[model samples]
Target: MDIRWIFDGKFFVLDGIDGFSARTSTRLASDEEIKIDAYLKQVHSAHVFVIDDPEVMPRGEIEGDGLITDIPAIAIGVRTADCYPIFLMDIKGRTAAILHAGWRGSYKGIVKRALEILFEQFGISPGDTVAAFGPGICGNCYEVGEELMEFFPPEFFRRRNGKLFLDLFEFNRKILEENGIEWIVPPPACTYEDDRLYSYRRRKDKSRLISTVEILPS
Candidate 1:
C-alpha cells in the first residue's frame, strides 16, 4: 500500500507520492514558468542536464533529456507518463541521475548521452553506473506499429506478434549492461496495464503522470 520508494531503493519518492500523481499541475494546472523558477529545466525530452552544486538552485530555463549530479543534497526530478523514469547512481555515492526516457528521448539516445556526459564532464565511468528503472507502460500494453521500431536499432526494439513493442526498460537495461553497468533493479508494474496508474497509452487521452525522484534529508 505504501509505495513511497520506487525500484526498491534506487532513490527516494517523497512519501506523498506513489508512482504517478495524475493532477501534478505541471502542465494543465501549472506551467513550469508559473510553478518552479528557472532552476528546474525541461528536456523536450533529448539532452542531459548535470547538477553539481546541490546548493545552487538557479532558475535555469534549459530543456534537455536526462539530469546527472554529484551534489548529494540537491534532488533532481524527472516527469513522465508512460515513459520510463530511471535513476542512475554511482557506487561512490557522489553522483546520481534523473533521466526521462520517452519514445522520442529514447530514439535520441538520452541515456547514452548521460553516460557520455558523466565521463566527459564529470569523469564518471559507465561501468560504475547502477540503474534503477521505475514503472512505465509494459510491452504487453505498449502497442505500437513499425514506426516506433525506427526510433531504435534492432537491439533496442523487438518484434512481437507482427507488431512492434518498445521495451524501454530492456533497451536501456541492455544499454547500461553493454556499457559495463551491471547493477540494475526494475519495477514490476505497468502503467498502461494497471488502472491505478496513469497511462497515456491505455487512457488514450492527454494527461501527464508525475514520477519524481529526489534525494532526501536536505
Candidate 2:
C-alpha cells in the first residue's frame, strides 16, 4: 500500500499482493481508512464523469475512463492492470480526478478530457493543477504493434532491436504540459516488471489494482 497526501486528501495506490479485487483488497489494505465513492466500468474511452454529488453518482455502472470531483470525503477511483492510473488534483480548488489510461484510452485523449472537466466545471486552471502517476507498464516493457503508429505520434514510439515500444507516461505528460500543467510526479514502478503488481499484458490476468483519490473534509 502506497499512500500520499494530495489535495489535502488521501491518495492511495494498492498493489496485488492479497488479491486483485478492488472491493476486498483496497479496503483491507487501507484498513478501511478510505472508501471509494465512485468508479467506472472503464471502456477504454475518453469519456469522463463529473461527481458533484457522490450520494447520487452511480458506482461501477457508468462506462467511462475518468472521474472528477470536488466534493469532500468522496473518493474517486480507477482500476488497472498494466495500464496507467493517473491522479489529477487542483490543489487550490480542492478538486481531484482519477483516470484509467490504457492504450485505447490514451489514444482517445482521456487526460485531455479530464482536464477539460476540471476547468469547465470547477474553474480550475492547468497552472494550479498537479498530477501523480501510479504503477503501469513502462515503455521498455510495453511493446506495441505498427498499428499503433497510426494513432500516436512518432515521438511516443521507440525502436529497440526491431521491436517498437510506447511510452504512455510521456504521451500523457505531453498533453498535460501542453495545457500548462507543470507539476507532474514522475511515475513509479512498472507493472509488467513488478510481480507484486498486477499486469494483464504479462500474465493475461483479469484481476486489477485500484488507485483512488479524494478531497479531505474541511
Candidate 3:
C-alpha cells in the first residue's frame, strides 16, 4: 500500500501499488495478492467493464483497459510498469474510471473508446471531465521500433536522434482532447528514469508497475 495521493482539490489518485493482476507474473509476492471478490480490474486488456451484476464479481477476464462504474462498493484497477495509468472522473468527481494505456492498449485506442463509452453509457462528456496521468514511461525512455512508430495514428510517437520515443502522455492527451476532455495533469517524472515507480524498460527482468485507484466521493 505504498500509495501517493495526487489530487487537484476535487479528484484524488492512490498510486504505486502494482498488482501483478490477471497474470501469472512471478514478481508479485504471494502475500501481495488482493482477493477482492467484489473488486474488478481490466488486467491490461482493451475491453471495458461496467458493474451491472450485483452477484459478487469473479476473477476478472484478461481483456480490458478502462473500467468505469457508478456502483458503490465496486473498485476498479489498472496495472502498469512503463505503461500509462490514467484516472478520469465525471459527475463533479462522483463517478470515476481507471485506465490502462500500454503501447498495445494505446494502439487499440482503448482510452478513446473508454471516453466514448462514458458519454454513451453514463451520459458524461469529455468537457465535464478531469484526468490524471499517473507515473509511466515518459517520452525520454520509451524508445521503440519503427514498426511501433508506424502503428500509432500519426500523433503517438515523437522522433529524436533518428529514433522514436513513445510519448504516452501526449498521445493520450490528444485522444482526450479530441473527445472533449480538456483538463489534464501531467507529472514531470518518468517511471523508467525514476526509482519511485517500476519500469519495464528500465529493468526488463522484473520491475514493479504502478497501479492507481480513485474512489469517487460519497
Candidate 4:
C-alpha cells in the first residue's frame, strides 16, 4: 500500500499501488494498525449521504458518491481510478466528507449537495471548510465526446484539432468556488499522466486509488 498522508493529519491518499481494491469497510475491518472505523463508499451514481442520518449509519456500504460525518475517528473514504476524489473538512465544526466526482456526478451536482448537507446538518459554512482535489485524469489526457462536453462550463473544455478534453479539476473547482468554498488544495498529480498512480483510462483494470478523511476523537 503506497499511501500518502495529507491534509494536516489522518486524511490519506493511496498512491502508486497496483491492483489493490480492498473495499473501504473491508480494509477498516482488517486494520489493526489504525484505531479508526471506516465508512464504506459506494460511488459514481451522483448520490450523497449524511453519516449521522439514521438511514445511513447502519449500512455496511453507502450507496452514494459522497459521504459526510461529524463522528470522531470514523473515516470517510472514496475510491477512484480516473475520476476525481474530493475531500472536504470543516475544522471548527469537526466535520468532514469525501466525494467521488466523475463527470456524471459533477454534472448532477454532487459537490453542491455535499456542501448543502454540511451546512444544514453540521452548521458548517462554506468559508469554514477546506478541501483537496486528489489525483485523477487531467484535462490534457481526458478527451470526451460532445455529449459529455455539453454539460461543462466553457472554460473547462479544451479543443485540440477538433478533439475536446475535459478539465476535471477546473470543472470541480468552479463548482466549489461557486458554492463559496475558496480554500481548495489543487490536485498534486494526474492519474493518466503519472504512471505512479492508477487510472481506468490508462490501466483498463479494477485497480483504484482510495482517498480518505477522518476527524480525530476529542
Candidate 5:
C-alpha cells in the first residue's frame, strides 16, 4: 500500500503488501490499495501487463516485457518480484514506457525493443529520453550458473569466492548507452537486500511490486 519511489516528475513504484493486487492490463479500479486506482482518477490512465508466454495472447491478453505510450495519462506498468523494472520517459515528446526485464527477457533484448518502439513510434531518439532502473536484484546478491555466463560478456559477470554474479544494472545500462542514451538514473535500492521491497530471490514471494509511469494530463 506504500509508494516506494516516484520519478520523471510523474512515474511511481509501489511496494508490495498482503492481499494487495491490481489488474495491470486494462480495467482500472479504485479500492485495491495498489494505488493504480488513485492514479487512474488523477489522470485517467490505462494499464497493461507483460506476459512471459507467447501463446497466451489469444485470450484477450497482451504479451510483452515492455509497454510504451505517447497518450497522456495512460499508466503503463510492469510487475516484478526480483527482476529489473525499468522506466523510460521522453519528456520532450511526452512519451513513456515501463519494462519488466528478467534474465530471459533481458537475454532476448526487451529494453532494446522498447527503445526501438519509442524511436519508431514517437520519433524520440535515444539521447533525448531519460531512462531509470527501479529496485531489483543487485549484482552482489544475484548469482547464476556457468551456463548463463555464455549470454553475458565478461564485463557483466564477476567471479567472487568461486561464484558468478551478473550485473543486470550495468548490463542494461550498457544497452541504453549503446543505443545513444546517456541520461540514466541509477537504481535506488536492491530488492533482495532491502526488506521494504519485494524480492523473489530473497523470499520467493509470489506477490509482485508494480512499477508504473503516466504522463500528467495536458
Candidate 6:
C-alpha cells in the first residue's frame, strides 16, 4: 500500500496491491492521485507506444507492452502478475515510460527497445534516464524451461535441484546498463514472495497489480 517516488521526486511510481487489477480499472480507488491516463492491451510483445496528444488520453485500446510520454498529468501504466513492471524517467522529469517485461517481452528486448524509442521519438538519452523495477517473481522463485537458456545468457539462469530459474531483474538490468543507463532502483518487493502483491506464478491469480508513473503536473 506504500507509494514510491523516483526521478529526484519529480515523479511518483506506484505498484498496486493485491486484488486491484488495471484490467478492470485504472484507479485503485476513486481518491487515488496517480490515476492512469493510458495503459496497453499488453500482449507481452516488445512494442511500445508514443503518446504525444492529450486527446489520446486513455489508450487501453492500444495493443503494446510499453508506453512513453512527456505530457504531465498523463499517467501511463502496465499491468503485471509475475512479470516485471519497469519504470523509466528522464533526469529533468520531462518524460516518463512504463514497460511490461515478461520473459517473452524481455527476450524480445523490451527494455532496449523502449530506450531506443525514448531517444528516437523524444530525444531522451539513456544517460539522462533513471529506471526502477516493480515487484515481480524473484530469481530464486522463477523456475524456467531449458529453452530459455538458448535465448538468455547463462549468467541469468540458475540451476538448483534439477530446475532452472531466470533472474529477470538482472537480465533487464544488463540491458539497461549496457545502453548507458545508471541509477537503477531495485524492486521494493518480490511478487511471488510477498503476499501483498499478486503473482500469477504463485497463486494462478487472474488479477494483476498495475504499476504506474506520472510526471508531476507543472
> What is the TM-score of each predicted model, taking all chains together?
0.73, 0.85, 0.76, 0.79, 0.75, 0.85
lDDT of each: 0.60, 0.76, 0.62, 0.70, 0.64, 0.77
Sorted on lDDT, best first, the list reads: 6, 2, 4, 5, 3, 1
Weakest 10 consecutive residues of candidate 1 by summed lDDT: 18-27
Give the clashing residue pairs of candidate 6, or none.
none
State residue 49's C-alpha deviation in candidate 2, in Å.
Answer: 0.4
Minimum summed lDDT over a 10-residue window in model 6 is located at 18-27
Worst 10 residues of 2 by lDDT: 18-27
lDDT of 1 by residue, 14-41 (tens): 2332222112212223334222211336
For model 4, how does the per-residue alpha-carbon lDDT over 18-129 read when each residue is reduced to its tens digit? 2221112212222343333454456466677777743445244547888877776566667678788887878573788888889989888888888888888778988877
Candidate 1 TM-score, true structure as reference: 0.73
Give the C-alpha lDDT of model 2.
0.76
The candidate scoring highest on lDDT is: 6
lDDT of 6 by residue, 1-218 (tens): 23243221222234332212112121232325346778889898999988888887656777899998888877688878889988887867688888999999999999999999888878987777777787789999999989889889999999899999999999999999999887687876777886666789988988877777777765
Model 6 segments more than 4 A misplaced: 1-34
Candidate 1: Cα lDDT at 65:
59
Give lDDT tens digits, candidate 5, residues 1-218: 23234322222332221211112211122225443311111111122333223333222244456666565545556667778878777756467777777777787787888888778866887766777778778889898999998888988988899999998899989999999988776677787887766788888877767766666666
Better of 1 and 2 by lDDT: 2
Model 4 root-mean-square deviation: 6.7
Model 4 TM-score, 2 decimals: 0.79
